[model samples]
Target: MEDYYVHPTSIVDAGASIGRGTKIWHFCHIQSGAKIGDGCSFGQNINVANNVVIGNGVKVQNNVSLYEGVELEDYVFCGPSMVFTNDLTPRARYPKGHMGYKKTLVRHDATIGANATVVCGHTLGEFCTIAAGAVVTKDVLPHALMAGVPARQIGWVCKCGQVLDKNLHCPDCGTQYLFVDEKAGICKCGGGE
Candidate 1:
């Protein structure tokens, strides 16, 4: 595609779908059946497995691997060395193939920091931030900031990647957010002001 940039050292399979203005850097491998949207960037040594879905304006840093059954919404950021797994119980010699795939969703504008591990079957809410080296095993709420082992929410964040103040407002972007508790035991945000 004329709008995309793929380094000569990168290997993109024949069946892979790359969108407009996407940039794939050195040593990256995008497998067949992977769908990458417009204005995305995949840094060095990144690997995107088949059946993976990456949305528009996503920024994936170096050394990341997005496994099968993972879907990233628009404007998502995946930091360096971040890993995503579709299998809950991965064995060294298991051969279930794609039948064992478990879906993982990263919502719009979310940021997953460097060296983080995201287990499958969980949805990261919109505008959420997962700090570096965190292991995410459960669903993250909207605008939440999660860190540490097992990924606990230490505070709330805004879509602009700023931690929210006491008034639920982001000073960096002057964006306001609302937290609502639903019957599903999840907190939802109404987006920026």
Candidate 2:
């Protein structure tokens, strides 16, 4: 028996692997060789390209296109209109895959804010926050708050996506999270082993 949910307007190709309890909403297209995990949700007008890996419990909002070489770890949040690019250079005459492509990794529990642009070859650390409209060209550290053009670290964020309070604690849930020195770049929180 099938376990996932695909909307009537959505098209999931034959080679795509969609796990149990996932919900793909309106006008979505899941291309061949894509692998989507359980309990994930893709909002309207979404496109998941071939060879993409979408982890369990991820939430992708509307107008998102997860192109090839984009891997989203479990519990990741992709906000509305976010864009992930695989190929750095583009020409109408010169096709991609001919020049090769680099991958972008969004680690577990990371939150990518609305309209963000994730340039290829960067690793977004676990529980990291990429602020709205940020263009990420470099790797982000865990629990870091990134904003502005090209995305520089402005502050720190908790795993719950809450801005850390004065004591580096989550004011909303009282869950203590990690904070690394801006210079040292070391990070650990409640789940640190």
Per-model RMSD to reference: 2.4, 2.4
lDDT tens digits by residue: candidate 1, 36-144: 9999998899999998999999999999999899999999999989999898887878766889889999999999999999999999999889999999999998878
Clashing pairs in 2: none
Candidate 2 local accuracy as lDDT? 0.88
Q: Backbone clashes in each candidate structure, one number apiece?
A: 1, 0
Give the C-alpha lDDT of model 1: 0.89
Worst 10 residues of 2 by lDDT: 184-193
Model 1: pairs clashing at backbone N, Cα or C within 3 Å: 3-21
Q: After superposition, how far is residue 169 of candidate 2 from its true place, in Å?
A: 2.4
- What Cα-based lDDT does every candidate model obtain? 0.89, 0.88
Among all windows of 10 consecutive residues in model 1, the one with the lowest summed lDDT is 182-191
